[model samples]
Target: MPLTRVALLKGKSRAYRKAILDGVYKAMREAFDVPEGDLFMLIDEYKPSNFLYGETYLGIERDDDLVIIQITANNTRTTEKKKALYAKIVELLGEDPGIKPENIFINLVEVQKENWSFGNGIAQYG
Candidate 1:
């Protein structure tokens, strides 16, 4: 399972936020091959003043609606899989929240599977 963190500007409606989460989860299932019950995610909304980012980073114009998604998962996926995941996320999110692909930024942090612990103070994956 992967832990997803979605960082975006505050003030979006509940439905809108849910759409974002749903879209990401769908993408993960399709591209990352995540199991049916493995869903785990969090949304961090920040005030405009605190949510800082470049408007034209890497020559890609971004706006207030920018979304920064970071996912922490096991380092078992190949580069091709990573690319597919990114594309699927952008596509799914675009269909739902209508977020521009340019504004959808994603980062993946892969670690060993042994680092995970489902609960009970047990390193289940280990």
Candidate 2:
């Protein structure tokens, strides 16, 4: 399971935001091999003054449309799979919301499966 947090500049339309969530979830299902109904995602909007980044970090020029996505999940995926997941997220988001490739930022936080407790004080995936 993956818990995704998406941060972007405020003032986007509801459809645009939904597209981001849908694109990320679709990519996780296709590339991360996430099971159906495992969706857990959040989106946070920040004002331009509050959101800051290097406009030309690593030779990639980012614009105001930049989106920052951070995902936390079990540390069970191989390196190759992780790469695929990132690529897929960009691809899907690009196709839907038309976000520029250079504007997409993703961070993955991996943890032991036992770290998650779905409900009732039980580590469901552990």
- Tell how far residue 51 is off in model 2, in angstroms: 0.3
Off by over 4 Å in 1: none
What would the per-residue lDDT of candidate 1 be over residues 32-61, giving only the tens digit for each residue? 989998988999999988999999989999
Error of 1 at 75 (Å): 0.3
Tell me the tens digit of each residue's lDDT in model 2 across 81-106: 99999999999999989999999999
Clashing pairs in 2: none
Clashes of 2: 0
Give per-residue lDDT, candidate 1, residue 72.
97
Task: Write down the TM-score for model 1.
Answer: 0.98
Model 2 bad stretches (over 4 Å):
none
- Alpha-carbon shift of residue 41 in model 1 (angstroms): 0.6
